[model samples]
Target: MPFQHPKETGYGHVIERYVTRKDSDHPRYLELGSRRVLRPGWPHAERFTRHLIDDAAAITDVELEALLAYEWRSRLTAAWLIGVDQRTSFRERIGDLLLASEVCYSGGGYCFALARLGTHADAEILTAYLDRYLPRTDLRYDQPEALGALLRLDAHLGTQHADRFTEPDGLWDQWVQALAHLQDSPDYTPAEQRRWTDLHCDFASGWARP
Candidate 1:
């Protein structure tokens, strides 16, 4: 089947389908992620997030865990948008389903979501993703999204680049340090955060360039 961006939301909002592909090589094992997101410019974005948050709050602990594990990447940022710090299994469930989720399997665009919930295992997953979906060859080079996310996570965790993900030239180390500085500081304002996110979205969208 041709890959389609269905306009379904957690609620009943109708979104225009995102750009679709005709003969995509979708992963056979695609697992679902957080259903919090709506169409990119949907008018009901806030309502969608609120609905999911309320739905999450009313569910049993089991359901909440599923909600958190459902990060369509960004660790499913909306959950935290409403402050899931006190929600059941917030940390425990985040990224727990990576091995089973098809988010990264789809392509580099989805892999971009890894940074929000970045972990050691996710780093490994991206490494493998690059190898499989964007691998390098003497005559072929793939522009992988793995770099940006890896750099951001290294900063978030305040750590040097992991050896497995590192290239021999130490470029990853310098890049990670620079990205860490750009991270939201104690004084970073909400407006600044929005700008940063907008910039990120631009860069991420460009990753679609072939």
Candidate 2:
């Protein structure tokens, strides 16, 4: 039988086609096969997440929360789809979701994603989690990557409610501390700095007085 459009037959058939591929050893075949499933309107992204959650696969509760907390539109949509399918309590589960996303995923992009989500009503729990997570000096706070993620979160969400750690406290101070941590490291590329600076400056200038 020929593969039908999602509208013609729904998403289950599409998933079945993707999962049944026998040529797992062929990279090009696998890539094309994956793309075939992920094409713009297939709707399997949500279906996959929901399947994973419902089956209670090896994925941990924290991992599930992280998947839900992902900032990418596609990923978030998938997470929402999963939440809808499971009929889980989003408000009750939001804190864990945010924490899992923040802790498990690294990179400025993830931070920005979390910040965007933070603007929502469910994000207050996320903000509270950060307050508790960032202050533990005993933990690995010295890493520039960790600091960068914090800076990105603060950059997007603003730093008013959280307690200050770096001296000369305020948003600027937090950013500077993050920058300084990255300064001596060779791995800290200029492009990353430029990106962070652009976001930081744009945000800072928005509130500047005439």
Give the number of the best model, judged by lDDT. Answer: 2
What is candidate 1's local distance difference test score? 0.35
| Cα lDDT tens digits for candidate 2, 31-122 | 22232333456444344434433433233344444434433332333332233233233444443444544433232223323333434333
Worst 10 residues of 2 by lDDT: 26-35
lDDT of 1 by residue, 132-152 (tens): 432222211112245544455
Which lDDT values do the candidates have, in the order given? 0.35, 0.37
Give me the displacement of residue 118 in model 2, in angstroms.
4.7
lDDT of 2: 0.37
Model 2 lDDT, residue 159, Cα: 56
lDDT, residue 20, model 2: 26
TM-score: which candidate is best?
Answer: 1
Clashing pairs in 2: none
